[model samples]
Target: MTNTAATEIDDTSSAFTPNLTIDVGGAPMLYRRTGRSSHTVPPLVLLQHFRGNLDYWDPLLLDTLAADRDVITVDLHGVGGSGGQTPDNVSDMTRNAIAFITALGLTEIDLLGFSLGGHIAQEIALVRPRLLRRLVLAGTAPQGAPDLHRWSEDVYRWATGDVTAPEDFISLFFSGSDDGRQRAWEYLARTHTRQQDRDPESSLACRDAQFQALMTWGIPESAKLQRLSAITQPTLVANGDNDTMMYTKNSQLLAENIGGAQLRIYPDAGHGFLDQYPVQFGQHVRQFLGC
Candidate 1:
């Protein structure tokens, strides 16, 4: 188990010292920033996958984004540094996220969300369309909403002491990419330190709350395909070719649904598309931002 604290590059450094908490709406949330770009250029915010900690974000990839814009990567409510307190679930997560940005005093910025984060990003767009300059949805889906029922149950069991069958838990999140399943498996192996006190149990509590709150997540059930017209921001929808969970068609569906939204499908990618192809993914994001 790698602590990764000694060499941690993304969270804190003398250079990117953030004020930790912000008064967004009513919730005081934790967020980190890096790079020194001025207000002339908008900042960038990142939303990671299901139960993703800020430390879990691949450092090299974050540094890449940091070079171009001030980047904000947050641990969503009930996960990571921000997971203290009651979130109510992903629905509340959406509300808290908007507050996180608003509290930071950022009105317009580029937003990127991966996997579960993508779900939150979409909900935010619905609630506060004007707050975003652009929106990027990566390795996520508009459907397959509660298909996580069993997965959530598994998380509950795993958290309570059942060893997470790493393969079953992880295979669904990968898409065969530049490195195929081997690389995906290897990266997961390297990063998978059982955090014990801070491991899956706490996360499952949040997921259970989210599962219940999903009943009111406000994501369209018939889930209107044309709802993207309401989003007044340039959008990029992308995913890996072999994402087992959301699949490529989901990305296509989002792009097709959202007005003027562009779709980019990677040749040998999985749900961890950005991690598998960081350079290419970063380049694509830069292009989308018109940088």
Candidate 2:
């Protein structure tokens, strides 16, 4: 008698889906899950840039990737709706991420990290080894890259400012070209489509802690590049040709040291190139992820 009761599937493929929460280590961790589930492809977990909350992602990019497979984005401890003190070091951040993943009951998955999140992804891969099936690092650098311990003067003006305006975001993420600015505007529009239940802005404590962690991670130790050999998962390293925030060369360095890692550089773009070329980059990611 109950065989024909509501056969339609629940479609959570939209980035505007309401935020969900789960307890991780006695604290609530906020996250969003999108797209359809696949038996062969693991859910793609995303980590955002410094000072970015779960709502910072471009919805167009998320939906594009979600069309084929599941996508998950988390607020990480103390960063948004998630509860806990923000960690001051990448090691502690990685531990928090691991705890979140474990609480999700996931054994293997894919990871995509942007900027600060990319650093955490690399740490997770090295520390856990077998946890990730694939890795994607965008607009980020490896630890101990020479002269990368601090932000450049021009970059410091916008990235560390008390308030980030559209102009600041344009300067930090897109290229100076007119076309690049147009793309940035479009990407910004897409990110705002979700009108309700948005994650709160990251706190000043989170910003300061993250910056300190970056400084510590970039202490100019060359041997850290050698550590890339430990991560055996298939990796995709991508960035804009002129990423002022993390530098384009860092992406090259990541690809070079990671052994057979693929690299993609978007022309006339900057740190947020992935968002600037959302559809294209999303397709590239889907292809790389084999979704």
Candidate 3:
């Protein structure tokens, strides 16, 4: 295992630094570690959404979760400071994630994955169930979900049409209500707070690869919904009531299919529901993790 000594910062003021790197499968993987873990409580490993890196996390949410338990956020292969070509499928991405976790000497962890990250998390749990103690899937859906292709296509059109405009995010992540729009601006502001040593923005090629993987996962044959029954760990599935990127019903399906999974759908929110209700969501996660 290899890492830089974690630099401490005032928890009330700034987010923790994420300057550590380790070798995984002959490639460099970058991650940020915060908080301290007790003998009984395991560290929380966070996986980023599509085109996201360590810096993309909501500081309020990340700090809130880290206040009571250790948190580790990583940049997947080829997305940020991590080295290697980006995998075009969830299975390969899961393999690299397992490599990164094992390289860090973490035998057990609580996994939290958002959007695309959630898909990867499910794969990890299925492929290597023993490695995880708990699982959290937010703003995501199961494989081969009905109407997923249409929603993904619409989201893609909106996302690509005005990549430079901040307003585009409002439409993509939040609802049409006034409160949702207000929270969308606040969320945008929070993402820009971390200025130094931030990970690079994902390239167009990376985005294309991610969408390809997403479309493939949407196909009925590639879905592993039936295999989800194999997951026995305590799981928390959450999303907004009006999620357009991945329909809210998928969350219901996941909760129903995954035995004993807890589900929460925030009202008047969209794909970025966690960002909309960070404190409440954090509390829910902390309670579920028993921290």
Off by over 4 Å in 1: 1-19, 23-28, 83-90, 143-170, 176-178, 185-202, 213-220
Better of 1 and 2 by TM-score: 2
Each prediction's whole-model lDDT (CA): 0.65, 0.87, 0.82
**Which runs of model 3 end up more than 4 angstroms from their true locations?**
1-16, 161-164, 221-223
Error of 2 at 220 (Å): 0.9
Clashes of each: 5, 0, 0
Question: Residue-wise lDDT of candidate 3 within 173-209, one digit each (tens)?
Answer: 8898988877777767666666678778777767777
- Can you tell me which runs of candidate 2 are displaced by over 4 Å? 1-13
Q: Ten residues in a row with the worst lDDT in model 2?
A: 1-10
Error of 1 at 170 (Å): 4.1
Model 2: per-residue Cα lDDT over 1-291, one tens digit each: 121211211234365677899998788999999888999899999999999998788777888888978889998888988888889999999999999999999999999999999999999999998899999999999999866787899888888877888889889999999888777777666666556788998888888888898889888999999999888899999999999888999999999999889999999989999978888999999999998
Q: Which ten-residue region of model 1 has the weakest summed lDDT? A: 193-202
Q: Which of candidates 1 and 2 reaches a greater lDDT?
A: 2
Q: How accurate is candidate 1 locally (lDDT)?
A: 0.65
- Give residue 129's lDDT in candidate 1 (0 to 100): 81
Model 3 lDDT vs. the true structure?
0.82
